[model samples]
Target: MKDLIILWLSGGNDAWWSVLVAMGNPWQVLDLGAVLALIVVGMQIAVATCLPDRLWADDGTNAFFSQLSYLHIFLLMALTALAEEIFFRAAIQSLLVEWLHSVAAGIAVPAAIFAVAQRARPASCASASRAAPATASSWG
Candidate 1:
């Protein structure tokens, strides 16, 4: 994580805490993150409820989620988010940036890999929601 942050910042000087304390203010960063999270959650809720059924037709993905208790769902979502960030952002993307010497390549390569991975997953595996934020972060 520290190496990734140093590579990302391009200074090779920022400590690992820079990842946790963005812009030198952890509280402000957390507040902003919370707002963004709420917006994403609200958008998801709106999509699930307001979109036509045909838009989200019951594939095994729906069935997969429906079987899980709320606790399990939340835990899976948290774990998925953590793992994706660590792998896609901290590891793969960092290496791509260093190797390719291009930030755009760094972002696009992992996103393409992520899309491919998502497509390759079994129907009863992870949900598309788990990929949304990772994709967004890559392009954002």
Candidate 2:
């Protein structure tokens, strides 16, 4: 639903393809994505360990995901990665090049937007729980 709106916002551009096409290095892209994901998770772990529990994910966010099965989790992960990369990274990377007149701005702006947007709230996430959910994944 939101992906459709974002694609429309990009003036019908299929940036998912364009970004991949322009990048021209599949291995590197995959490696970068993996490294970035690992780094983010590591950082989150560090934050969780070191910081006081001053801030937290909305409890609803935890409850919502907890209800999903392994299949649902897999689907959510795949769809989220694909949809977000296309709209936020691909679309912004190209459009910003033209509008902002700087490659850095193009990359940075969208990256910030993506981060802030994700943190803002998970739509339909379990209702404002501060604690991280239990580790028992649906598959387990």
Candidate 3:
């Protein structure tokens, strides 16, 4: 978690720097707003497209909204994307570019690190799910 947070802050700082360099106006409110808006829209599109049918499929008795509000889900997705982009794309990769002076190396290094970091959670979840039935049968 701490590593992730550090990555995010660094990414945000790098993103700010990149914008400053490209626009020569770091403090431009409009540019900042546009960047944020783009992030949100991108997130929404990704979610809408990637979500499982069980979660978003049309059924006459669909209870998705009742079970989990759209706002809550949106907030979760936004926060995750913001954190990931900031840490992996902005901060770590930017640092790597500065160190190696190679764009491909910079991007690859952080991407690999991010992929490893992300795999931990899902791997653990899968292991736990696989063990669940065995544990239940042992109790019976």
Candidate 4:
């Protein structure tokens, strides 16, 4: 994929596994915290879905995705995840860490960039933040 190409070009091809770890570890068992987090997230989603559209506007994202076939949707989601992990974590973050000589700088700088870029496109970060209000409502 283009992400791998970018990583290779950045001289980070050898560290690709680091980005895979960021994506997630398939071998790791889910801990209590992970299970609890999933439960809380599911509850948040359920509550959010029950809310009226007036409180949480549709924003046409669901409408757009609704038009896609299930296979297309799955592929889109998978490829997007892979691309983001490789480009951001492997390429950009790795480059930043090497250049800045600070692991914290590497993580923080790419995260900020990702946040801004996601806001501009209203796709990645927006989806994650969509659950945020649901979380607040649950606490209230």
TM-score of 3: 0.45
Q: For model 1, how does the per-residue alpha-carbon lDDT over 2-53 read when each residue is reduced to its tens digit?
A: 4444567786565544565556666866776797789999999998889865
Error of 3 at 126 (Å): 5.0
- lDDT scores of the candidates, listed in order: 0.75, 0.72, 0.70, 0.75
In model 1, which runs have C-alpha deviations exceeding 4 angstroms?
1-23, 52-55, 119-140
lDDT, residue 41, model 4: 86
| TM-score: the better of candidates 1 and 4 | 1
Candidate 4 regions with alpha-carbon error over 4 angstroms: 1-37, 121-140
- Residue 71, candidate 4: how far off, in angstroms? 2.6
Where does the lowest 10-residue lDDT sum fall in candidate 4? 24-33
- Model 4 scores a C-alpha lDDT of 0.75
TM-score of every candidate relative to the true structure: 0.57, 0.49, 0.45, 0.54
Clashing pairs in 4: none
**Cα lDDT tens digits for candidate 3, 23-103:** 655466466668778999899999999986545523323465567688887887789999999988888999999999998
Q: For model 2, what is the error of residue 31's alpha carbon versus the real structure, in angstroms, after optimal superposition? A: 4.2
Task: Please list the residue runs of candidate 3 whose C-alpha ends up more than 4 Å from where it truly belongs after superposition.
Answer: 1-66, 122-127, 133-140
TM-score, structure 2 vs. true: 0.49
